[model samples]
Target: MANPPLTPEDQERYQARLQALIVEHRDLDQVISHLAENPPPDQLLVPRLKKRKLQLRDQIWEVEALLMPDEPA
Candidate 1:
């Protein structure tokens, strides 16, 4: 089912949240890269970080869809 359209306040909130998620995702990418390069990275930590990054990406996509939903033809 289609979700109800967001009000102006809700849209603003979502935009803020999306921006924060994007920043966090970028930061995680940098950390993951650094960890991979620094010798003998913790096996457990890297995987966990990668997983979190994926989750963040999913969340960002969801918020974007909410903020800018597609129109029907």
Candidate 2:
């Protein structure tokens, strides 16, 4: 069955949310890099941050999927 189409407003909202998530994910990547380079990094905090980054990535992919139109087979 074909999925219901999204309203314009819904697409706009999803785009905005996706952008925010991408920014956050990028920030996390930089922070992780900095922490790894610095001595005495907080090992526990790094793992948690990495996990959150992964979650954000998943959310990003989901939002992207929603925004994109289905391809005809």
Candidate 3:
């Protein structure tokens, strides 16, 4: 079954969430890079940060897909 279209308010909320997730993902990338450069990086923390970043990326993709679904051929 087709999903119902999002209301204007829902669209706005989704956009806001998507932006926030993108920002968080970018921030995590910076932190991860910095940590890798610094001597004796916390092996545990680095992996956790990377995992979170991947989760955020997945969320961003989901929101984007909801906002603009692919058209059928």
Evaluate all candidate structures by whole-model CA lDDT and list the values in order: 0.90, 0.89, 0.89
lDDT of 3 by residue, 1-73 (tens): 5556888998899999999999999999999898889834456998899999999999999899887745663
lDDT of 2: 0.89
Clash count, one per candidate: 0, 0, 0
Best by TM-score: 2
Q: Per-residue alpha-carbon lDDT of model 1 for 1-73, expressed as tens digits? A: 5658889999999999999999999999999998888844457998899999999999999998888756773
Q: Could you tell me every candidate's TM-score relative to the true structure?
A: 0.87, 0.88, 0.87
Show the colliding residue pairs in model 1: none
Choose the strongest candidate by lDDT: 1
What order do you get sorting by lDDT, best first? 1, 2, 3
Per-residue lDDT for 8-67 in model 2, tens only?
999999999999999999999998898888834456988888999999999999899888
